[model samples]
Target: MTVTLSDEARQYIGAFEEETEATAVDCLVDDEFDRLVFVVKAGEMPKAIGEGGETVQHLEEEFGRDVELVEDAPTAEGFVANALSPAAVYNVTISEMGEEDETVAYAEVAHEDRGVAIGKEGRNIKAAKELAKRHFDIDDIQLT
Candidate 1:
């Protein structure tokens, strides 16, 4: 599937690369969450983050919006794992759901990290779902 980004998103991507010198696979503008999620190219996450996350903080300050960085993965399970970072997900199980052509992800997160994985108001999981749909055609995420 081809993804056509909006003008603002394209501009944001340009600015992000210029600011951080890290290649971004795609940019997600989550207006409802009042944040921007940059899907960075794999093997460049540390470069995108910079030392002590100074780059990300700078972006947040300059854009006046929350910024999240998720590393791009080569597969559906890997993508789901990357999306739930800082949450210590043990594994992600992908399975076809029903006859509606839906795909569901069962993420096994550490018990202690459950809240972190879900996030406040389920923001993290929702973002994961959205990104999964955008990049991997996954329909849902279910934390188990």
Candidate 2:
């Protein structure tokens, strides 16, 4: 599915690319929490985040909203793993769901990191779901 962005979101992405000089693959704007999450090109997270996370801090201050960065991955499993970064995931099993025209990703996350995997008010998982669906056609991400 092609993920279309609004004019404002497009502009935000443009600004991010210009400032960070890191290729942005996709972006999601969480209006409810006033947060913006970006997926940067693989192996470029260090440049996107800058030394000591200064880049992310600058983007947050300029956008007047919280910012999050997700590193791009080549495989579906790897993508899901990256989406749940900082949350220790033991495995990501990809399977086709016969009931629907969608795929499912069962992520085995560390018991201690379960809550972190599903962020406050479910924002983290929600973002992961959206990005997975858009970029990888993964319908659901269940933390096992």
lDDT of 1 by residue, 46-141 (tens): 989989999999999998999999999999899998999889989999999798978999999999998988889988988889899999889999
Cα error, residue 12 of model 1, in Å, equals 0.5
Span of ten consecutive residues with least summed lDDT in model 2: 1-10
The root-mean-square deviation over C-alpha atoms between each candidate and the true structure, in angstroms, is 1.0, 1.1
Candidate with top TM-score is 1
lDDT of 2 by residue, 1-144 (tens): 567887877888899999999988888988988999998999989989999999999999999999999998888899999999889999999998675756899999999999999999998899998899988899899999
lDDT of 1 at 26: 82
What does the lDDT read for residue 74 in candidate 1? Answer: 90
TM-score of each: 0.96, 0.95
Task: Show the colliding residue pairs in model 2.
Answer: none
Error of 2 at 43 (Å): 0.8
Cα deviation of 119, candidate 1, in Å: 0.8
Runs in model 2 lying further than 4 Å from the true structure:
none
After the best TM-score superposition of candidate 2, give how far the Cα of residue 118 lies from its true spot, in angstroms. 0.4
